[model samples]
Target: MFSESMGRITGLVPSRFLTLLAHLVIVVTIFWTRDINVQASLPPDFTSEEYEEEDLNVLPASTEVILVIAVFVLKKKSF
Candidate 1:
């Protein structure tokens, strides 16, 4: 069913050639519109001391509780 559409093309271009043409067009478009003068900047007064450490010790305990509950549910369903 999928091959039926392949026969309708008026051009004799192979699928590989068409794919290459698409890639060439994409590359040309990217190079044609790319800005070369952009500069990166950081905010004023930014420091590592301003960032607080995140607490992640409670996540494993909650995940273990959820997994234990899930195992009990699966065991109940299988029996």
Candidate 2:
């Protein structure tokens, strides 16, 4: 019984690792392409100075908080 339980727990490791890796890659990709995203979202006439003044960090920070809460809720339910 103990071995069976351990086996089930161990089976989750690879999937969890891959999930973590995928999330990291996605976060990195979003940050890497952020400038392009900002330009696309703003008016074409927007100046560099205006872009420099934009508060772009808020969305990512809130998204991270939401993701963490969601993961915790899902983990609690799964166990």
Candidate 3:
């Protein structure tokens, strides 16, 4: 039956591998769409220097957010 075949396929692949694949897909999707996203979020007259400055400002905040989320996930998993 189809269900049986699907169950066998799922069992053959590790859950961690699936999770990594999903993460990679999402990262690639974001990477490809970022220019469109930035244009929508920024003013039409924005220069390259302004965009670079915005990117620099975001880097630290994004890092801090990732760290906080990582800590939260670790703590939750420890419980």
TM-score of each model, in listed order: 0.30, 0.56, 0.45
Task: Residues 1-79, candidate 2: write the lDDT tens digits.
Answer: 2247454565466677688767766776766677777777779899887786553543664477568657756775442
Q: Write down the lDDT that model 2 would get.
A: 0.66
lDDT tens per residue, model 1, 10-31: 4444674577566556544544
Worst 10 residues of 3 by lDDT: 1-10
User: What ranges in model 2 sit over 4 Å off?
Assistant: 1-8, 58-79
lDDT of 3 by residue, 1-79 (tens): 2247444445334665567556656655655565666666679899998787666654554465466456546764321
lDDT of 2 at 64: 77
* Candidate of highest TM-score: 2
lDDT of each: 0.42, 0.66, 0.59
lDDT of 3 at 40: 68
Pairs in steric clash, model 2:
none
Clashes of each: 0, 0, 0
Better of 2 and 3 by TM-score: 2
Return the top candidate by lDDT.
2
Order the candidate numbers by lDDT, best to worst.
2, 3, 1
